[model samples]
Target: MGAPLSAWPWENLGIFKYMLYGPFVGRVMYEIFYEEEKDWKFSWCLQLLILSAVRGLVYLFWNCYTNSLFLTRNRQILKQGVDFKQIDKEWDWDNFLILQTIFASMAYYMFPFLQNLPTWNSKGVIAALIFHVGISEPLYYWVHKKFHGDYLFTNYHSLHHSSPVPQSLTAGHGTVLEHMFLSLVIGIPILGASLMGYGSISMIYGYILIFDFLRSLGHCNVEFIPHNLFETFPFMRYIMYTPTYHTLHHTEKDCNFCLFMPLFDALGNTLSSKSWELHKSYSAGNDSRVPEFVFLAHIVDITSAMHGQCCLRTFASLPFRTRFFLIPFFPFAVIGVSAMWLWSKTFLFSFYYLRDRLHQTWVVPRCGFMYFLPFATEGINKHIEQAILTADKIGVKVISLAALNKNESLNGGGKLFVDKHPNLRVRVVHGNTLTAAVILDEIPKDATEVFLTGATSKLGRAIALYLCQKKVKVLMLTLSTERFEKVQKEAPLEYQSYLVQVTKYQAAQHCKTWIVGKWITPREQNWAPRGTHFHQFVVPPIFAFRRDCTYGDLAAMRLPKDVEGLGCCEYTMDRGVVHACHAGGIVHMLEGWTHHEVGAIDVDRIDVVWKAAMKHDLRPLSSGSTIKAN
Candidate 1:
């Protein structure tokens, strides 16, 4: 169904809709700049904006808190995770607050009674509560029941119901008309008290804060309220609704439409018979689902750190790009980094399902630059070790180390952990075997000679050995001839001649097939022939500087279509695709391999892992295609 006429005019503006507050902001600015004395109305407007900001932070805190696996374990009401559709649908959850601000501004101009309100009125609190309980509750109940009727249900109410598994934002998600009704239901209590000379700034703030608190509590999808509380004081159930109570309204629809009170639903005979039972079940902490697979990841940079699913769902769903709005938060990000460095440990990042198995991603609180800092290696390894131990204790089947977490220098690509805990049942995987495989699969089969950069590195060494065995001449690029000879000797004597050491880019000027395992400058890239394709396995992938040559993405694979609940992208990869190492870990889990894939890449298992990946329908994204960079 199309959006109703009551939809917000600036709904399509997305995050930029906050700019609507500009005029109110300008009013306060003008009063401060030009006038020695400010109008009370203008000052109140500023207070409203500040209050809205604080309320927004409250919602954000709840969102992150509920999503924290450790804190909310077994307390989650819905098993299903939010998808990109729900994220986009609820992106403008603060629109209602903005609308309320606009309404308050209009009412001040229209009614002279609202001016010069006192800072606090104890009687106003009593009046506001009475008005809310006696008037707003019943009015909202009837309006909600009516909206479920044929015309309104189809055209308006369905948008809110679209999210069966709700978050805090879901409480504010509805049609503009729906919010208009909500504003009146909520506003009348405050305004009525004001007109009767019982309204105060404290009363307004307290009433709205409680209103939002209850609304968010009902929609957060976490069963934090203890069942014993309701059992002890049975009357409290009629007074307040739990998250489980409101979830039934979305899932079971037709029943439990009351706002904040089950008493309304009880009176209307619309309350679900199972509401109490479900609440008890959720509050008892019985539905914990531990993931079988976890991909251990670390932040690549300051900008990449903000691309977390919890930080910004909309931004994380797409390939990452630097947004102008993010610039304002750079100082806060620096503080967060400092905090993480000092006190943070491994935490759950995101999760999804594939073939009835739970797959999670965990993050180590360190940036890419931190990995290179000599002093930070011990700290980073400690976080990783703790994560592995925790996963093992929880009976996790597999945990894959991503990117710099598996650095050869740090822990010999995770060999340190596995060796340190030899009795550990949980399989640790570097997933680099499949990374080498994906990069190798991208090279043309007919090409006899290939120029290799970073030839002495792990994947590079494996690649040189594997290619030489196939009779492909590998011009190994390295300054250290000793390192080149060391990797070359790994191949059979017959293939050793095929792996030749070369120190400079000029050695590959005639070579058309280039396998890049290191970051190369525009000048280094120019050495390859005009028609050459660059296959890479480097971090932050090499820049595509030459328009004449086609550049390949870092090794990655499209996950099988059977996957579900995947809302956010993995760094810069597309929606359903993930880094080859991430996919490799998935394959490791799906194949039920008992071995730990650590240390150097296994040259023999390259084909085996590649074939297993293919068997599971994880297609290589870089194969048979060329990416031309401008």
Candidate 2:
């Protein structure tokens, strides 16, 4: 059986018609207005000069923003070895700086003679601008292949190609020869159109500079295109020239010739089918396929710095926005200032409440954390020892079984004392069978504090579940906002609400959280079975007893330290969960946690707090342990 005929072929055929017929139609109109100007020398020069200078400025500023994002997100923000060192070196032989100046200056000198031409009418003027963008870009595209030929690429184009990760600055990166050749691409058609009376000097050259910014933007390394902008429309999606389109050009060196649209490349069939596929998938390039950058948890730190700066200014006798003109911008100003308030309310409270009891600056590492094994680091050997030491003032003696060597540091250590305090011996147990037998042998018959810690991994989650199965009031601590959200949605109503109220202070700092119990309400059965992504959730109560829950959530000592808050209740967002709307949400449960069949919370629905509360019909989870604060 043969493959079905493809629609892409038909689509290419239509583009071919547009490309071939477009310039011919343009040239026909040019012949109608052909006229000789008495003096053309100075005007042509002046127009070209202004065009280049203005475009260069726009390109420079845009490049700055795009470059900063690429470098910062990639952790190249601080600059690295050999490649970075080479950046400061000047290789201005390829500098387009002189070329832009030369062109803009020449245009200024030539405008007088070029401007008074009889063909400089508004219609012809617009056509001249149209012709500059319309033809020069296609010409560059059609000829870029030959430019990348062995001879030209090695000396002329290779300099620009050096920025495989091209920034906006890289847009103008070409050898002196390439810079010279670029002018011809615009000038030849432009001058010919002028000789044929197409349009005037001013509009034609002005459009050329605009094309510069377009190409510069097209070459930006960052993926700034909002997917929603183009995806909803069928025709526009394919037509838009994405950063991917230009990036693919740098990679293969064969397909990037056309820049304006697929009009040239699609019709010519020179565009990479692979590029198109990636564009459709929205991956852009493999380099851009990075883990998410979490600005939510980070916002608190940035805001703190900004607020401090503002306060300092005020203390020094300067108001933030005292000028009259700044009044109208107050709404935007308020939003800018309110970043702290928004983060604290929305993410701070929820996420920190889920991550930990300490308000620390938490960083979510890229790549899965599954590969890390439990081990020693930074003076903490047995995790239980550390927990014991932390609670030692109260006469607690803890032992850890983490020495069995299956778990990693943070993952193991956090789990051993999660929501629990140490008073007895803890032994490290590895392998599923060994851990089960050990648990069967010695259960904490009179454990005073029962809590769960560790990652949502097979080993860690299992340990927590085992504690939960013993009817131990487990303290569940999730690392990512995504995990916290999943657990909250999956847990029974009481557990869910208790998590919120208990962790509010912790959630306030880092947008990550740590809640300390699992009491399956009827609400859990309803929400959990529906699959744990999102559901209508009520805000958990603020007080978990007579104590302010925020104060209690922060009372834990060993949590990661926050950028601000000086070691108070802190949390860190798992960068992995920045945009649930965009990111893949597969939950990574602790290795041992899933296997035990500890049973899930039972709930079919939750209409209100009282309905779920009535279903709970038991003392609040924290009521048993919480003593009235002094």
Candidate 3:
């Protein structure tokens, strides 16, 4: 059986028509406009410079106007005004123009490289252009991919990626090496056509103008292409690249490598998953508001098929010395085992778009089973870094680390991430402020005494101090008596008497309200009194509690009926509670503040953040519905 006609290379016909006819039109227009010019060299140089400047200025104006309109349409208020500091840092117009002039002057000197053909013919020009495209596609793909590597990216390509919401002027705002590489890529095609003795001076100049225009359009940050054009003539998509296509390449460096055409990208299997949908939405002129912030959480599952549970179980069974010996091999083993399950496994990172009436957010989940394993610190940290990098690539303004991710990253709150990835322009937040607010809201108004487990831990200590400051007696319980005593002493002299330090679980019976600050096993849950109201902070709450006990994960608590949950965490508890950390970050983003509220949760700021969160009508997930960590 043969393939259908639709499967054939009919798309190439569009490329042929544009390449052949475009240059022919340019030739006729040039002769009519510049027939009197005797010095071909000087005339060509002047024409190239004028065209480049005019195209750059026009696109620059268009980019600025559209971006301003987009902000107004989406109701995005820039709290800090325009990020001129960032623009100044990323854009070196003086240096860029200098390099451009040098490149143009050099090209003027190398005019001999362009072989003047004896006659202009449609068939010859088309054949030459086809050959030029075919040769340039693969070369550009590999070089472009090379720029994505760590060394090259940091040293050269990072400048290009600096403009997340890219303007047309950003097209030429790259490092010397980056611009040099681009020059070669653009020149190779024209040089090839010239060397083939098939294109005239006018034809060559026409090709340059077209290339420059397309390059500017690709970086314009506005989608002007018609959506239905691709649907009506499906083959055109493969032949012509749209603005959305190149924007994705800038945001997501892993895909869409082809410059002028998507042929290489399709063949290389590097197209982004959201590319087509983004194209459709942008092309349709839909109000596709870009994400201002993203929240990152790992899906916590001990028994899921893709979580490497079997390996975790085996690792748990190994002796201490054997486990230590196998530690180095764990990553390699994981890679080998994961390859077999790759087809069935969900991606390591997945994106979800969420919005409420007042706000919009992006939630990204990192997939892994080792998050629960105490010894898998390195593995967990690596995954968190990956999620951060991914969020940065997508131009997320702020990223909040959820649950276990906060713990592994030094609960430095989010400072560790900021320090580690200094180059990642996005801000890192632990979302702990909102978590603290939610937990505080749940505390019984009449209860003067409260039992706080993991009192020496970060969140536990913070909550204990908060309770003591409010004149509610806090029964601080922890395995470390020394740490417990230290925390008690650190309290203000006036509030010290309200801090009750306990080193034993049995002492928790003295308090009616129990707050579990850390992840507890079933055995640990038994220590709580029979009818205590338990506010749990950890995820997948310890469910096997006494029948009389009322339990809820305080951090995941949702707001009242009037408030809407903005899809922070994936799961909901008994009432419509969301993860407090996720909600806190959302509140911050909504307020347009870039504060990193991880370990530094303040008692005074809780009410402010809480009121803002309540405005959105944030609710908890329905009971029994499974949500992955946001």
Candidate 4:
């Protein structure tokens, strides 16, 4: 924009291109006169032409209004960190022109472009609308199928989804060749029907306008469909739409096609059967692989929490020996739970809160007015609980410790303070007040297990160094694979290195993780055991074992695959629990957890806890594995 308008590409051609569409449409209208009604004089034809032009112009203006903020994003804001890459491609006006010409031609000549027959009768208008759907929809559906086949999607349909955040104006702003091809794909059927005295051309105009309006509405960021409509008239769901449904299409979810009706999509197998309930996940690691077996993992981030399908599939697939059916049926095992809960309360008075239905509290959140209510509540609270547990174990005053400055770190007297177990009796200080001596304050008096978020700040680095010098157990938390690499690269190189480093060393080590972005602790791990939402509140389990945890050992692993042991990662730490991204958390369990760490994890100066056994350590409660407090 700093350059003069003369340097701008295509600034001159825009006016010329705009003028070209007028004559092109005009010629098409002139041919339509042959099908004009006898009652419709030249004056009427002129009126129709003017009306169409006005309607098209009005539609275009509406898109302009909605996108008034479009030009603002063009300005650079400071320096760019990560370019979203939505606008990197070069634009070619000529290619767009060619496409427009093709779509317009197919829409006009190949399809029945005139519907003057409807000007004479009332039913003619209604019949014309029905006839348009009967013809074009089927034809478009089949052709669209071709565009989605293997090897075709990346080169073809991908261009349209480049803008994941499609604004209202982005409607139909794709290659014109696509438009022309579709026109022939659609219009020819109408043309054939019209020649057979079965179709009216005016319907074609109505269909295009309706398609554009509804499609644009679907692309809007706001939710137009009232919740009451979806809940009350379930049958009418396919009638109107909610924003969540359409916006997901602009993302990497490849298989969702069909704009007008879901019929083609349903038959095409492109519709995500999991869309309804796929958003209730609470993972701490980055290995979200979207498991093919359950497909439930995909929903964890969405709302796909339903376990019904898994149960059915497991029941059908598992043999008696493998106990695969036991996998999915776990969610439903709570059947006799209430009865036992009542008995325990009435007689033994154990698990009293659970047995007494009136006082029973659920760790899992329940639904309220909105659908995602329970999920949102649980997700928020679960993270917070982890934060609190981590803080408590780190040995700090739960009340005094607060979140740290994102750009900096916090320390507590020669030891990085954490609010892990909640029994601390100390005051928290501002980041500016922190120093190396303040960090090493009081060596936990005489505590055992040490914990640390390794990638904290310089203050954290000082505290960690002091702790290491003292020979206290050092628990390091490393986050974000990219930053992990920066430190890892500068780290004493273990040569045998070539591209980045030129030498070799016999004894060297580097950080095990490689996540993206900064390692966040407080905001991510809600220090509170539970978080409250506008409608509901939630409390998540903190023990390594979970109650009602559907995936057994997977309950501890983030984005865990199935119960199957996929073998060890580079961390040399393979447990059903410690995947590479989350191995830092296993520091607390290091006391007796060596057996579970399948990979050759560096166990130096570590003491992993050992428990989960059928004999003594771990016992099964209805909820999950449990080890009683000493």
Cα-based lDDT for every prediction: 0.86, 0.37, 0.59, 0.33
**Per-residue C-alpha lDDT of model 1 across residues 352-372, encoded as one tens digit per residue:** 888889998998989899899
lDDT of 2 by residue, 60-102 (tens): 5554444332222332211111122123221221145445445
Error of 3 at 580 (Å): 1.4
Off by over 4 Å in 2: 1-53, 67-86, 89-94, 107-112, 115-126, 188-206, 224-240, 283-630
lDDT of 1: 0.86
Q: After superposition, how far is residue 214 of candidate 4 from its true place, in Å?
A: 1.6
Please estimate how well model 4 matches the true structure, expressed as its whole-model Cα lDDT.
0.33
- What is the clash tally of candidate 3? 15
Task: Pick out the ten consecutive residues of candidate 4 with the lowest summed lDDT.
Answer: 346-355
Estimated TM-score for each candidate:
0.94, 0.38, 0.45, 0.34
* TM-score top scorer: 1
Q: Number of clashing residue pairs in every model?
A: 0, 72, 15, 62
Please, what are the lDDT tens digits per residue for candidate 4 over residues 508-616?
1121111111232333323212321010001121232212121111112221221221211111112222221122222222222222111112212121211212122
List the candidates ranked by TM-score, beginning with the highest: 1, 3, 2, 4
